[model samples]
Structure formats: C-alpha cells, structure tokens
Target chain A: MSIPINSSKAIFPGLITREREPVNLEFAFPTLDGRITPAEQFYVRSHFPIPEIKAEEWRLSIEGEVEHPFILTFEELKQMPARTVMATLECAGNGRSKLVPKAKGLLWEQGAVGNAEWTGVPLHLLLEKAGLKAGVIEIILEGQDEGTISEEPKAPGTIVFAHSLPLDKALQEQVLIAFEMNGEPLTAIHGYPVRAIIPGWYGMASVKWLIKITATATRFHSYWQTLEYAYWKDLYGKPTLVPVTEMQVKAEIARPALQEVVAAGSIYRVTGAAWSGEQVVEQVEISTDDGQSWQPATLLEEPVRYAWQLWEFAWNVPPTPGAYQLRARATDAAGHSQPDTHEDMRRTYMVNFVAPVEVIVK
Target chain B: MSIPINSSKAIFPGLITREREPVNLEFAFPTLDGRITPAEQFYVRSHFPIPEIKAEEWRLSIEGEVEHPFILTFEELKQMPARTVMATLECAGNGRSKLVPKAKGLLWEQGAVGNAEWTGVPLHLLLEKAGLKAGVIEIILEGQDEGTISEEPKAPGTIVFAHSLPLDKALQEQVLIAFEMNGEPLTAIHGYPVRAIIPGWYGMASVKWLIKITATATRFHSYWQTLEYAYWKDLYGKPTLVPVTEMQVKAEIARPALQEVVAAGSIYRVTGAAWSGEQVVEQVEISTDDGQSWQPATLLEEPVRYAWQLWEFAWNVPPTPGAYQLRARATDAAGHSQPDTHEDMRRTYMVNFVAPVEVIVK
Candidate 1:
C-alpha cells in the first residue's frame, strides 16, 4: 500500500519550496538562526511519500554476505550503547538553482542543508555482530519508502529508495543506525524509529526509514547510485560519470539577506555559514567589493566532524549610497575551495561556485 | 494595576536564570545556531513583571522639548514606514559571574547576548514628526513595567525601567521603535506592542514595553542610568563612576561545549562569536595551546553594526591524547582588543577578557 503524503503540518512556518509533494525547506530558513537546525525545522527531501511503520512491528533485516543473517526488533536495537554525532546533511543538488540553464531536479537554493545531533548505535558494531564475509565489496541500505521511477523505464518498476557504500566507508566508526535527532525521537518526516546516518556524505547516502542492510560481494548499482545522483563530465572530449558523494565546500550569507538595504556610513554585520562534507572547513573569506578585496570572517564555535561551521564578517558601509555586491568563499582542510564560477558539468549536482548577494546602501 | 509577570509560557525552553520572579534568559541559548536569535529564543532581561497592555488602549507619548507633544496609537504607529534591523542586545551585567567579589544582580554567562531582526519605524522619523526643540539634551525612554527597588531605598518607592540617550544618538536613523521581532508581533514578555531598539547600547538603553519618549532640555539622570548600571572605577587613586553603555569586544566559544571530549588526531573545528557595541570586530584569533601561539579564525559573515559575528578555526587534534586549552580573543575597528585578563575594575559591568575553553582529547 502507498503511504499518503501529508503536507499540512506547520512545523516549519515560512519554509520556501520548489516542490510541495516531497517537501523542501527554503534556502534561507535554517541560516536565519542557530547552528543545529531544530528537528522540527530540519529539511526533508523525500522522493516518495513517508511510510508509516509501527515501532513495535518494525524490524531491520541484515542479509547477504553475512555469516549469520538476522533480524532485529526496534527495542532490541535500542539495547546497545548509543553514540551521538553532529552531522550536516545536504541534498546532492543543493545549489542547482544558481546554475545557468537550470538543472532538472529540485532547484534548491542553499537551504537544502542542515546540521543535527544524531544518536544511535554504530553501524560498524552492528556489522561486526552480523559477521561480515571477507569478500564483501559493498553494503546497500534500503529505506521503506518505495515508488515507481517512471523517469527510468529501464530500471525496476517499483523499488525502495536505496544506495550503497564501499566496504571501507560502510564499516567506518562514524556511520550509525540513528533513532534520535537533536535529542528527540525522530519524527515521521525525518524517518521515525530508524534511519542511517552516513556522516560526510550527501543526504542521499543516508537512507531514512531504513528497513534493510545487505552486504554484497560486488559493487552494487541501483537507480540512485548509477542513473541518478551522478554528474556527467567531459574528460578529454569523453563522457565520464562520477557519483555525487561527499559535499564540496560552500558558503552562504544568512543575514543582510539578498537585496537587503542598509544605511550608508553605518556598520552592518554580515554573516553566513559554511560546510564541507568529508573534511573540516579551513577558512571562509568575505569580499564586500565584489571580490576586489577579501577579508576574513571570524568563525563561530569549534567545528564538529560532519557539521557545518557558522561564520561572520564586519562590513563598514561606504558613505556613498548605492548597490554593492557581497560574496563569501570557503575552503576545506582537503585544500578544496569554492571556485568563482560554476563548473561546466552535464548535471548540476554540486554547484559550489561563489554566488554573489546584492545589497543596496541607502 | 500592577502588570502581571507570567511564566506560563516557555518561550525559552532552557533559559538559565538568576531570578524567576522577573524573567531573564540566560546568556548561552542565543548562540546555539544561525545569526538572528528566534523571537521565542531571544533573551529576556526584565526587571518587573510584563505589563498587560491592550493593543487598542496602548499609546506612546512623545513629550517634553518638542514643538508638538503628541500621543500615537498602536494603529497610527504601524502606519509609518517600517525599518528592519538585525541588532545585538546584551545585558550590561553580562559577565558579572566572572567577578571575584561576586557583583550584585544577575550572574549571567555569555548567553546574555542575542541578535534579532527588529521591525518598526525609525526613531528619527518619529522624532521628526514630534519636531524636536533646538536645545534638546537627551531623549528619555520609559517602559510601563514598574517595581520598587529594595537596593535604592533613597529613591522613589515605585519606578519604571527608564534610561536616556544623548541627543545625537536619539536622532540617529538606526534607533528604532520596534514592534515586530523575527517576522512576528512581539510577545508580552518581550514588550509586545512597542520597544526601543538602540542598536549599539546595553540592553538597559533599549527599554522594553515602552510607553513614553521624552526629549529633555537637560540631561535626564534616572536611577537606572545614574545609580544602578554605572560602574565605579579608580582613576589615579580617585573613585570615578562611568555609565555602562556600549558593549566591549567579547568572544565566546559556542560548540564542542566546555569540557567536551574529542578524538585524538581528528580534525575539529573550533568556533565562537565576537562582538563590539559600536565598532566592528577587526580580528579574532584562536590559540589551541594556551596563549603561546595564536592563529586567525575565519569569520563567517560580515560584521553587523551591533550584532555578534560568528567565527571558526580548524583545530587539528594532536596525535597524543591529553587536555588542551583553547583561547579566543577579538579586536574591534578602533584597535581596542580583548585583554588577556579581566580589568581591575571595582564594578563588573563590562568584562572583555580572553576566555579559555578546556577540552580533553582521547
């Protein structure tokens, strides 16, 4: 039976949306305040309607390349010691709206990302209990939410939203089967009862409403892993497909919002947040005069692994009143930084260019 | 009738407090995430219980040194063009807890500061409508909430929370008569119908539940301004008293909270926020190994006029496991930076000293 999609909740009061059916928080809301996006205001990106599963009846199955395939009930899973981590989840197509010739998916602005404290048992511990085989090459996680992928006729008619990680990534100590978000039980929209928290990866890699985990001896290819969520690049005049996995470094202005007006000769505080998927953000710089000169913004708080860092800069408005452009760029510990312009890719999966916010000084 | 102080509503879920009879939002909640503190989460520093004023009956009186002394109804006030500003507010006794002798009143932590988007008519526009007199010396703002101060038996039995700003500051366009906060009408606890937003002054200067604005021919010296908020200091062995007004530069770490344990050899982001009352923060440096060496932190956004700017630094945990001391200091536009230790002042009003956050690595 198909789960009914409900969009009547007012959890997020002023959430902007590109698509209403699956629900998406506008790019401006999360950055408006605080660091951890409250669970109620956490962004929801679902391909299909949410599935309702009774906690008592819910069971997670571990099959395939395991020496002992087993099923664990929700209560049984909770009996283990839980680890908590603050991780940021961003849609693969977060900045697609900024791309020219607009990308064909959910045209998200920057609001497609949020950081939350997740609590759960480590996936590696569960994997160890399952007794993984030496030849295992990949681990596939499947969510209960299922729907027909009409866009891909060649794929199975109906399949669960699923993705796979290489054996090394799947066994990382940071990966977890999360049951709580921001100190509260996960809401239905955020995968109640159980979900997978794959730190440092795009939102797609962390399957919600998780139902099954399968260890395989060979690389697993699903519609999401092979057909969608991958960027096609022209390398030496040849098409090469690369899967969108970890998030690239990006920054966004939260206050003095786009097109905001300020009094001339007044000092205004400009602020925003920045994040990198797999590595810590090393630096974030703000350019008030359209990149002609750059000044460093003070980073707020200690960076947590898999969490975005908040940043700020002080801009002295010129005595003369007119339009001014503001831009922010972030660099990660991996030595990757945002480029000034968008890359020419076949798909707009990760648009990490330095987008300018225009402000008028009156 | 005395205004009733209601605590039935939980606007701030985790508000730390020194007194419950008169509400006060502790200093740590506002820096949790984002830039603007949400209306519900905005810190409250109230002396008397919130006065319940019917919106229809509420009137703001503009009297004293003006050609035309007039009263404005709520509707009339809303008819004027509204100006929105993201300003930071902090209690004058914010760092009183750090005082050695234990300063009188609330022992607030760093959470007393918050940035909010306030919307209302500019004070200058309203003053223009009132037609200011040629020699107006001060603008006195009076809130409706009133209570007897046991500490000042020589003063009036009942006194309203009142303060005055200089003529130049009162006429500044940044000063606002705010009625809306964070896109919603103000709550009763936050001065519902009207409150003054003095961009760069201490929270006392921005009187809440404001009902009167008086332009005085002579300097207005209220108990709040002259006796309570003033800091007694020793200048050349002579006792001198100075009014607490603008905020001094301060920095506080917001994440990996104090005494948090971190994994060794892991990359962690160390971040915090910094602010100066009237000037912009010019620099913020972080020292992981005490004050021996310092590295510049990346500021996240442009420095706001009266709001704190978030900052970050990537801290690479040393491979060996042990305790680490992290310290952050800020410098403002005037070249006035935070001191290594607290100033030797008789009163603990403004404490702008570098604070170290201790953490253990395992």
Candidate 2:
C-alpha cells in the first residue's frame, strides 16, 4: 500500500460509514478545531436507507390519548413559535466497532455523532395544543418508515419500529418537535419536516420520519422497537435476553491519529470530547506515565444544559526517545471516571473503560 | 418544510470526506449490500498532509541524546524485526463539536475516530537497532509536510501548530513505526507510506507525514506542538492553560435518531458507545426518569484495548401516550458513574457529564 501524500480540503462531518447493526463502526477524528461541527462535517449514522420526507406534505398529528387529536401541517407546526437549541445528536452505537471479541452490530470506530443548532416547535407545545387527558402516562412515537413484524426470525426478520416515553419527558420544555437543523430545514437523511429533539438521550429514543402518535395505558412491544435494541442476556448460558433503555458516561481522545509520528523536538496539544446521559462532566485528568500520576485539564464552556464538553491539555517533547503511556480520566459532577477493567459486568454491550494511550517518543 | 420519507441505511466506514473544523454536513451513502460499516467504509484521520515516502528512499534518523545517532531506511527498519498489533487510533477532539459555548476549534461531532489492525515494527525494536543514548528524556516528532508556522492563526487569533510526546510513551510496545493499517498499506488520509502508531493516546500526538524524529533533553515546542492544543485555566483567579496529553472517558448514543415517533405498543432498543483512557468500562447504566434512576446496559466486547465499546438496551412501551426521559451513565472498574454537573470542579474544559434525552411518547 502506498501512503497518501495530499490532504484534501473536502468538507468533513460525513462520518466514517460502517455496516449496520451487529457490525457498525466509528472512527476517531483528528481535527481539534474546537467549534461547531459545521453542517457539512457532522457524522451520519443510518440504520435503514436515508429517508427522504416530503416537506410540503408532512403532517404531524397530535392525537390518541389527548382530548384534542389534531393533525398539523408542516407549515402549521413551523408557525407555532419556533425554538432553537444547539444540541448534540449522537447515535447510540457511535463507537461500536472498537469493541473487543467483536460485536453483533455496526463496527463503528467513532464518527456516528453530530451536533447542530436545531430549530423547531416544542413537543410540549404541541402536546399542550392537543390538550392532554388525565391518566395519560405514556406517549407513543412512530415513524413513517414501515416494515413488518413476524413471530419467527427471517433473513431481515419481522420487525416494525415504534417507541414510547413517559409523559414526564414529553413535558420538559426543551423537548422539541424539530423541523430544521443548523438553522435550515431538515435534510432528508435527518428527520425532515418533523423529528423529536430529546436532548441528552441516546439516538435510539429519537425516531426519524415521524408519522403517528397514540396514547395508551399498557406498554408497547415491536420487534425493531424492543427486541433488537434492548439489552438481554442468555440467562446464564441460556438464550434469553433482556432490553436496554438508557445511556452511559463515556469519552475519547480526538487528536493524534494512531501510529502517526510527532516531530521529536516539537510540542503538541491533546484534546477530546466527553458526555453522559444523566450528568455533566465535573473534571478531566491526564496521565502521561500510565496511571501513576494525573493532572487536571481545561474544560470549554458549553451553551446547552444537556450537551457534551470539550477538553484540552498540552505536552512537551520528551528529553529522550523511549515509550510513553497516555491516559485521561473524567469525573462528573457526581464523580465518575473510567475503570481499570470491566470484568464484573454481565451484559457486555456498553463498555466505558478508562482510556489509555501507548506511544513511542522517537 | 416537509419531512422526506425514506429508508435509513447503516453508516459506512473509511468513506467519509474531510471538511473544515466545526464541520456540520450530511451524506447519503450508497451501500452494495446491507452490511455493517465494512473495512472499505472505514474513514481516515491524518494529521499534516499524507507523505509520499518511498520504501527505499525513506530513512529514519534517530539522533540527539543517543549513544550513536543512527539512520535507517524503511527496509532497514523492517529488517531489524517486525511486530504487529491490533489497535484503535482516536483523535483527541473527536467529539469537540459537541462542546457548548462553542470553543474555537474543529467542530467535530464524533466521526473522528476508528479502529483497525496495524502491522509495523515496534518502537522498541527500532530503538534496539539505534541504541538509546543518555540524558535523552524527550522525543520530538516532525512530519514531512512542509508549511511555515504562520503567526497568524486560522482564526483571527489562534495558536500555531507543532506537536510532541514523551520518550516513555514513544517506547511502549504498542507504539509502532507503523507502515500498514488493517493489513494493507496505509491510506493517504491515514498516515500513508510510514507513520507512528502510538496506541491509547490522542491522535494529535501521532503526527502524520513523518519526516523527523529527535531525542532531546530539553522541552520541544512548535505551532501545533506547543502553542496550540494546550489547555488553559484560572490559576488562582488567573488565566492559565496547558497542553492536552491524555484521553478521557466518554460515550455517545448511536441507534435512535432524534425526535423519532414510534407506534404505540412497541418495544424499542437504545444503544450507544463508551470509552475511557487507560481504564476499562465496568458498567453502563441508563435512566428513563432523568437522573432519578439508572439500569444496567448490555456491553459489547472490543478487540483493542484503546477502542470504544458498544452498548445496547431494550425498553417496552407503556400503553399510554406521554413523555419519557432517557439517560445513560458509564462506570469504570474504579467505580465511577456519570456526573450530574461540572460546577463543583475548579476547571471546566474536560466535561464528562452524563447526557440526558427527552422523548415524547404520543
């Protein structure tokens, strides 16, 4: 193989593509331009085909358990007081490819995430317009994308997609019925016309190509919605598995491509990104001598309450050529960092280990 | 605006296009078959421009602070002894785009990371050939890409570009004088021809377009090496910044698209990615009621020590239409979970807060 010698100025944000579930993959980005991931450079993660929703015909219906079940056109939803939020939308399997023993999903090595200034009407606003009825505890979200559900597994298997959330989350002010991304109308690949913006949650909860809403008293069960995405175990060597719902706190280094050499006599800056589903990062520390010592890093200020934070540190050249170890630790406001190992956890789907970098000085 | 109804496909790897920092863009990947990110789909992150180093012409000079300054060609380096490793290379600021208050740097929102099998001669193997000298405590790396370090910043006023690493880090067995990625010759965007593989550290420390390596006893500095990439903070109410050097523990949701609507009575799966520097993930927990509670998630095994882990969870729908809150938290073997805030910490750059998601059930 020949080494590429030219660095193209092509716009980024189109993240590394990988296989679908059971084999997805993500890559570590090397740029440290600490700013918004330009619309042209945001990562993309699609499960099926990129849906192309028609903007004019898009109609969001607010029905089901509400006193007022009304269907609103795209224009109607857009006119209901626009709210803008700079939020980060990440794929639940953004870094699946880097897992050990391999995984049964996309082999992503990072890059399945993106952040944007989303503009839309609040879901609460629409919920309020529909007029909620008492005893309405669950809200259902459905996408226009369709498939089939089967009792037995086939090649593609039978799975229709649908998800539901408790009424409390729908009431949050930040929950938005977004129609635009980065100040523009949603791209076809993104949930155009209408999509939910649930800040701080895994991307799985956010349905694309939204179509219907139904209110019920029981629970929901769809193959794609439940069976495939949930966390399950073989039941101590059995074939029985369970479901998964939330997210975890994790981070990654964003600079220095692996196996690349640095000018032996020069200095370089180290940077990365971090986020969690339930809390904000409290502090980040660095260790150059493996885990023997640690140092605090500088955290960048963020605009939204439920968003990831940027971090940075500096490293000078070593006086001799040898081997070195790199490690970073993050402490949330509640105090959390990566562990030395995760042997005790049973379901090995979400691995958030303390990151360590090993490199050569010369 | 109208919603474009279409199918979503899995993301491809290695096929991403490069863009300016703070990238925000979209891509419609065409897949031959429905596979997870294939090796061909993997993206690449190359610091500096890719180099055109001919195997015969390329010569590695290890001088300064060494017993005997030695120079060897690629053939010579390979002849000494060959070692290979399966490792993951990550960028320091892979998700920097998610940072709030929007810092002035690359606006990467994930997609800046990836994992691959690497083949190369270990740094130790090369060092044994050159022979280490006394008083050399640091290793300075310089790439072949030629460009003046202009005082003028990419922004109105930003730091220059130069990078460095410690000798100890440079000599790790994982650290390699790599020439291949994933069993193939390096791609241009990846360090083609020849590059260093410093596993476990930020991508920035692994300078691309290799040209020079020097052993030294004094601190090294460069545009990207010293001035830029370093962290700063208030030292006793004063602004103090330092260079970034290590990786952090972080995670991102991958499966669900934001604002997705599911049909009532459906089961949904939630998935994402998690990782840290040096430490392994112990457990990943998800919450549906903000931070009030959390449940464990299914973890995915990884091949390399520095790679990210995939996680999944399944949720059953509540028959009623309402709102739901989604959250995820990762615990390291050291017993750390996501944080609720970052306010308590004196520093703010490395925010590893647990992320939260809001979903509307109706």
Candidate 3:
C-alpha cells in the first residue's frame, strides 16, 4: 500500500495548513511577534480524530506500582493546585522537509514549533497523593487518542498514543498535567480538559488527550518509543537505534523571510527565536553573507528556563543589490550548538541543523 | 569549499538558470511548443566553462587500440559526412527535486530535457578508418573542459569530463561526432567544433567539448562513471553498484501548466511528451483524477527511435470548480511503464517516475 502522509487540509488564520484529519497547523513564522505564539497560530499535531471528550464525565486513573490506585475527576484534579510555566513545544520532526535522502514524515517547514504559557496541576502532587510503591522506574502516560499508523515503521495493528518518562524526570517541579494554555481553557483541538506538558523534550514525549497513567517497576518500551521516533545514534562507530528524546539547540530566522526582497542600503531588523533542550540558550550568531563570516546578535530579553530566547541583528545592507543568504545558529548554556549538516545520527528526527533563508536584496 | 550550484546570473526569455560556471540552462517545459525545442530553448548541461576553441585551430584525436592514431582537423571532420536525427536528451536527474529521502545532487525540476535534431558524422565511419584492435572493449570520449570537484563523491584532484561506451554500442550508426546543432555550427557552451551525440543514453554519456577518443582494452572507470553517476542496483536483495546508462521509460505533462486556472466545464486539451530508451514508446496514459482513473492519450505522431513521442488528451471538464491533478504514464514496446514510485534502485539518479501536474478549474 502507498504510505500515508500528513495530507491534512486543516487551516487556521495566521497559520500554515499542514494536515487535515487530525488538524495539524503551522505558524506563519515571518508574521510572528513577541515571545509567545498566539493560540490560533500554535502548531497542532494530532495522530487521531479529536475524541468527543467532556470535562464533566472525564476521570484520570493513577495505578500500577503505587500504594493506592485511585481516580480523580477533572474538577478534583484542577482543584488541587494551579501552576503556570512558559515553555517551548517543538515536534521532533519540525524540520522534516529539509532531511537529506528525503526521509518520510510530515513535510513540516520551520513553523512546527511555538512558545506558550501552560497552566496546570503539578504532576508530582498527584503522584505524591497516589503514593508510589517500592522500585518504581518509569511513568507511562497514555492518551485517549487511538489510530492505526499508515506510514513506514507502521504498527502491527491498532495502537494508542502513549509515552513513558523516567521516574526521576517525572518527579520534576515543572512537569504538569496541563488543562489550560496561555491562561485560557485548552481548546478542543489542543487536547481540551487534559494533557501532559513535558518541558525540555520533544512534543511527542508529552502525550495529549490524557486518559490514564501507570507507574511501572521497569523501563517501559512502547512501539512509538522504539520504532518511529527513534534515530541511529553512533556508539564507537557502531550505529544504534535509540529513541529521540531532547530537542537540540536550534535557531530560525523569522524576518526578511526566505526569498523576501528588501531595498538596498536599508537597515533591516533580522530577528528570530532560539531554543534548546534542558539548557537555556545563551548565545545566537547571524551570518549575513551566507557563512563567510558571522556576528553575534543581541538577545531581546534575558533567557528563561524552558522558554525560547528571542534575538535580533540590525543589518547595514550594502549599496550593491544581489541575492544574499542568511542563516542563524544558537548555542545553549551547556555548549550544544546547531550543526551545519545533519550527522549520520539522524533519520527524519532531531533535525536541528542550521537552515538558510535566502533573501533578494534589490 | 562548498560545491557550486546553479548560481548562474544568466537570464533569457524563458530559460531557467541551473548552473553559472558551466552555464547550464533548463527549458520552461510548460510553455513548450512543437516537436523540436528551439535552439535557445534547449536544455544545456555543461560540466565546466565553455572552452575557448577556434574552428580554424581545433582538432580531434582518435587513438588507443587502433592502427591509425591520427588527428582530424575541424574542416576534415565536417567534409566527410553529415546526418541529422531528432533525439531526446535528458539529464538522468531530471525529476531530481521529487526524490524521496531528500537525496542530494541537482534539485532539477522537470525541465532538464528536450528533443533536438543533431547533425554529425557516424562514429563507426571514423572507427573503420582508424581500424580498431580486437581487444578493444570500450570507446572513451573526453572533452577539453576541466575543473576541480568539491562535492560528494568528488574527484581526488582536478578531473576532465569523460565517459565511455561499450564496443558494440560505439559501433551503432546513430552515434555521432557532430559540429552542428539545429542546422547551425555548435555553440561553445553546447560543444564547439565537434561533440559526440550519444542517442538513447543519458546526457552525461554524451560528453561535450570534443578533444580526444581512446579505444581501450580494459573497461574504463572514470570518477564521473564509478563514483557519481553510479547507483545501487539490487541483485535478488544484495545491492550491487552499477553504472547508469540509457534513459528510462517515462512521460511528463506540459499543457494546462501547473496550477493554471481555467473556466469550469471547458474543453481542455492536455498535451505532453513521452520517451524511452532503445525501445520506442507504444502508449501514453493520462490520469485526470490523480491516478484513481486513467484514459489513453492520442499519440500526435508515431513514436520515433530515441526521440520523445508527443501525446494529447481532450477532456470535457466537470462543471464543478475544484482542483485536479494531471499525470502521464508511458509504456515502451518492452512493456516498461513509469513506476508509481521510485524503487530502491535509485539514488538521486534515474528519477524517471511519473510526476503530477496539478491544475485548478475556477
């Protein structure tokens, strides 16, 4: 059978249409403003039809390696505690269109990422309330979404969207069971009454449309974890397939868009956003003359823990008119910087390479 | 250093810029007319700068595994004999932009092909005059153009543009050593003085800028041959590296233009061209609904050996206003039709798969 692609026809104002059935959308990067992406412009990634979910009838179950297996109504969970954190959520396959070998996946451009303020109950509070038993290793989160994968690395049969996080990471203060986005109630398209917001990792790790959570005594290996989202990680020259976990340091140009034309000798504000996994972005460099030379761009604001850092460069365009290729690179506090080319340790995932935006200076 | 791309600043009425240093040009296929592409409209594939050669001072050397290792002046080569053949010349990587896994090479669209009437002397006549040795296995053709390779599978150092043909293939009467193109003396860019016209083979095999010919006893393995133009051919399931040869059976649509709009319920004449390797095209099929259904297109003229066969389809359009995808499929006398998808045998080359031309009826 011909492999299925993200042929979604869904569209939203100020957003780029990506896929339809599940309603995937992309932000119009060049039109972006400020740090937080508008709710209507935030990218939507769905694997199955939006479930007919209702907040009044919903319940969350905490079971398995726990002292007291229990259920909490949506109201009960929301009444516990409310905390908000600004974070960047990026699809692991964000820059899929640029992958070499034309790898299969959603042909997402540079808009598959966005920064948002999420408000929800701390996951640790619920876990502490349920009381963990001895030898708990990981927490498996399953969503209400279910569908058959029709692309490569397909499933054997019907499958549910699920992901597991190591218990140590799950106990962090920032992990949340989000029920609100940007201070507003989550929309039906954005996982409505419940979702897991996992900061510092790819969006796939944060299962949406949350239904149940299971504390396991051993490391969990879901099909999505081992097959599709996995990439070849080299260990001493040997390629090993490992699950893609974190978002590598990446910066993307948002102004003077690809192939945009500007008058010669004009002062243009070249601005963009940069983000990294676990570590905060510390520096961003811009190259106006392709990659011949580079200059540091000043950060618009101080770096945040889990949010994207915005940067800008004021260019003094030369009088001569010609085509100029612009590119940006970001480095995190941990010293991880975006690579010029995708190393062999990739297969349509973690494509945080530096992308060029060619503009015609006329 | 990064390898050069189609960085040419040259612009013509309708020709698409491909490469600058080599002055490679691509035809705007949708605006094409008639069987023979105009001289300026013909696709030009150059490996290096147009060599500086004067017809009064130029000479072609025929040597190696032959009794007469002599040279032929431009006037001598032209006075011997002249014949013209309307043949199709394709860049092997014509549909390179659509290759999956985002393979690297040229990101050519569907314009790197055209049919031209080549005028030249039959190569067999010159070989007979130079009496070949019994051990000769191949005829090596070299052009005067030279450059250093900086791309993947690059040459170890500076290399000349070269290719070789099998002994039997070289003896074919259709192969030509030509000094004229479209009834005019060859342009420096197309190949001045004399160049080999290799009918039925990919353009790379038809080396440009004629300089010398060597009849070799051993199979030739030039860098352009074994390293770049080679693809992985599967024997059973094991991949074996093989040299890319003749053009594959394929068809492409030209009319209605891509994304062109027309009045609803109008009678539309969809036209295009189809060609194959040695086997002549026998049939051309049209799909108006994106391959779900297909109808045979009327061949405008009988198929010709090594030349593109023009085909047209008249459709009574539906009254509804919507977008429609148009694609063409061609089959040769050998029953080889364009594959729906590129099998694993491809690696940025031999991208002769069926391509769609989407149009809108408003």
Question: What interface RMSD does every candidate have?
Answer: 36.3, 26.4, 16.4
Over 4 Å off in model 3, which ranges? A1-362, B1-12
Worst 10 residues of 3 chain B by lDDT: B1-10
All candidates: TM-score of chain A:
0.93, 0.83, 0.94
Off by over 4 Å in 1: A1-13, A152-154, A233-237, B1-362
User: Residue-wise lDDT of candidate 1 within A277-314, one digit each (tens)?
Assistant: 88999899999888998888878858877998887777
- TM-score of the second chain in each model? 0.92, 0.79, 0.94
Order of candidates by TM-score, top first? 3, 1, 2
Cα error, residue A199 of model 2, in Å, equals 0.7
lDDT, candidate 2, B25-134, per-residue tens:
22212221221223454445543334566667877777666676777777776676667765544565555544554544455554555556667878766566567777
For this target, which candidate reaches the highest TM-score against the unseen true structure? 3
Q: Could you tell me how far off, in angstroms, the CA of residue B103 lies in candidate 3 after the best superposition?
A: 2.8
CA lDDT for candidate 2: 0.58
Docking quality level of the chain pair in candidate 3: incorrect
Q: Looking only at chain A, give the TM-score of model 1 against the true structure.
A: 0.93
Tell me the tens digit of each residue's lDDT in model 3 across B1-362: 21122121222357888787668788888865667877788888887777898988988999988998889998899889778888888998888878766666667788899988899999998899999999998988888888876653234345678888999899999999987788988777788877899999988988888888888886565656555676655322223345688999988887777787866887787777888888899999998888998899888767789999887788677799999888899999999998888865456778888878888888
- Model 2 misplaced regions, further than 4 Å: A1-14, A20-28, A148-159, A232-245, A342-349, B1-362
**What TM-score fits each model?**
0.48, 0.45, 0.50
Query: Quick one: ranking by lDDT, best first?
Result: 3, 1, 2
* Candidate 3 lDDT by residue in tens digits, A1-362: 11122111222247778888878888877765778877888888888888878999988999888999899999998898879989899999898888766666688889889999999998898899889999998888888888876653334345678788889889988999999899998888788889999998899987888988888775554656655566654322223345678888999888777887877997777878999989999999999887889899988867888899877887777778999889899999999999888764566788888888888989
lDDT of each: 0.78, 0.58, 0.80
